[model samples]
Target: MARQPALSASLQPTLGAHRRLMAGLIPEAGFHAAPLDGVTFMRADANTTPAPVLQEPSIVLLGQGLKRSYLDGEVLAYAPGEILVVALPMQFDCDTVVQPGQPMLALSVRIDMAVVAELACQMDPLPPLPPGAPSAHARGLSVAPMDAALADALTRLLEVLGDAEASRVLGPQLLRELHYRVLQGPAGTGLRALAASQGRLGRVFRSIEQMRADPARELSVAALARDAGMSVSAFHEAFKRVTGHAPLQYLKLTRLHLARSWMLDHDLGAAEAAYRVGYGSASQFSREFKRLFGLPPSAARSQPVVPA
Candidate 1:
């Protein structure tokens, strides 16, 4: 018989210390030389309160204490040995319960669908997608345990980031290794579905990319359907099936999200931010911004963004 797999142990303090150091390296709200294009580290000390912000496609790993992410009326919690995978864009709030001395530290890796697909191609085939496999709606998020192997791999990757030349040379390889580990976990199938070509999730991703490229361009269901190579009705059904929202609604959300980020990162005024995101009317942009985020553009920008 195959030797029984060893039981995973509690997350040790050493990992926490490494995470603390990694958190110190991340710059505030700007790009830095991260090991991967989509990875960022976070450090916070608090309990129950979270800074509100929009979620993106990424994986969050807690190396110390516990935290919670709320979206779509659902509250998802993760502790030291667990991972959270978020595949769609949405408004989310998260906070930690770790106090002053022992703060909550976490790492986030943005998922690149292209990389995920390539890794899937190289791996052994997974059990065929379940009959009526899980839908790929905008509500695409999952939480699962962080195994020892994965934890160690993440720790090593962070350490590599401390060395400038080594990070430049081997960063991409280590990032791929991290993706492979996620593909081997329970969230694997969910990620594989998103990366699959011609699948509903994949089609949605392509459509979203198109919208992002030209948000101001008028988007019609029929036009998108033609581009997706599906009938209008089929496209509508599949779009909703994969994203939990109608195609038009999805586009609007995308526009608003980009607008918010623009205002926050570029210090753009309401009118300018609106115009940049393809909105012609400043009032219209403000109204939508207030509706989605519970604050108008100027006020929202003044609020603190949750750290990466």
Candidate 2:
């Protein structure tokens, strides 16, 4: 096989430091929360079967091994020295496979929209995105090369994980720096679009919030468009631009995710979970759940909920 492309030279040094820090910080299996709030370290010593999961908006950095995530039929693979930015909450499937001795090591930082908005304001203005450019709604997930500045900032953040005082005093600043670095990178435009409250992306996000508030409510494309103050045609285009899914499709997935949460968190049976999340028919819920998750409700209930 041809040799895989290497990380940029500017990024290599910090990537090495990140690997060492994570290896020392998380020496065993399972997800470990760091001293800093919203920061978590994960390690898996052996390969894992593909599993269904709920992922919130966050930044994921891989320091060792590899992993893959599937969302709406799109498969995204991440290796070392790359960063995965999820700009919204979505349910998806993930698989992480490790060699006999090498573990899959990763760092996850949950996004704080407030912080993201604040950081975006302080950064230099982003260039206008070209027509047909990928936006925050184009699935809300993006993978970008980890540049030297981001790598260094991440390394610094991880280094402070072992010191309580340092984490307390410097953690917030370092976290802000990391977010700033991301806003300055290639993916910055999408993130900025997501944070701009008066922008089209923001309107769609509000519509999403309405659906999340009541997933089972009788909703229509026209109603959602009216609420967003857009014509149906404009709403459809903008919504698809940001989320990569039509409004109705987004609602269906949201409902399924809600039902899954009920089953996993409250131990609700399939029928009860379905009704709780606004499904009127258990059979219909079961069919859709299996179609998206590759398992019937009964089987999905037995699987452990992976931390996002």
Candidate 3:
């Protein structure tokens, strides 16, 4: 059976310790790596402006506060006890809602395809894909209400991650349980398709992986399509169906995301960051960068937070 949150929908089963555990784990307002592998704890003291950011495959759960993500003219607003799952790397605009006294606390669990593949094989019959999720291979992100089973697993996982011995012993099992529960969710179909790695979505995913592997490469859409064993138009349609963005647009956004990371995480200058990401002309790079991130590269260099 699928999991549900502990308390009433709005309360999120804070029954006792989850919020307290997060408080002890997170010391300040920033994204913090946890003791357990593949898990991160996040806290934000103030509201964050909407900005385009790159999100890799992971499970994001809001424990306190609300977050709204914008994509393709649609708005996805999720509050506490709600979870968002992404099957692949994507760039989207995210805005965190928080107040001064009441901060936002969140958790991020990175997806492991190896574990997903193993689980997909073990289950006698895979969970049914939601009707809204088309083609049994559409890949992107989905938000759903957290049920009791998942909420219990997450609470236990947090408790286990708090202690050294418990984290070493039980963390893996709890982590696996969380992923298992998600596999039965609205987003399961895409994840299963990604795990199978043989269908059209699998082929499209490989091309995306190529872009992620080396955004600096001047990859042609035709070449990517050929490698996927599909014609250009077919590949284009399939790619958009799954990832929301067209092939070249996805590549450009990937390059811009890489440049932003270089500037913020590595302190690279504007021109250098653009050049590293395959931008030949600094002027053109700057123009495109601003158009996507809404700020110049220089601003990223000084930005203190990578929002949770």
Number of the top TM-score candidate = 3
Instruction: Encode model 3's per-residue lDDT on 109-191: one tens digit a residue.
Output: 99999999999888755556577665644657677777767777888988887787998889988889999988876556678
Off by over 4 Å in 3: 1-17, 127-133, 198-200, 304-308
Judged by whole-model lDDT over C-alpha atoms, candidate 1 comes out at 0.71
Q: What is the per-residue lDDT of model 2 for residues 146-202, given as tens digits with 9 covering 90 to 100?
A: 888888898889888889899999999999888888878865556777887647767
Specify the poorest-scoring 10-residue window by lDDT in model 1. 1-10
Candidate 2's TM-score reads 0.86
TM-score of each: 0.80, 0.86, 0.88
Which model, 2 or 3, shows the larger lDDT?
2
**Best-fitting candidate, measured by lDDT?**
2
Residue pairs with colliding backbones in model 2 are 137-242, 137-243, 138-242
Off by over 4 Å in 1: 1-7, 10-37, 48-52, 88-91, 130-139, 229-244
The predicted structure with the larger lDDT, 1 or 2, is 2
Q: For candidate 3, give the lDDT.
A: 0.79
Q: Quantify all predictions' global Cα lDDT against the true fold.
A: 0.71, 0.80, 0.79
For candidate 2, give the lDDT: 0.80
Residue 55 CA error for candidate 2 (Å)? Answer: 2.0
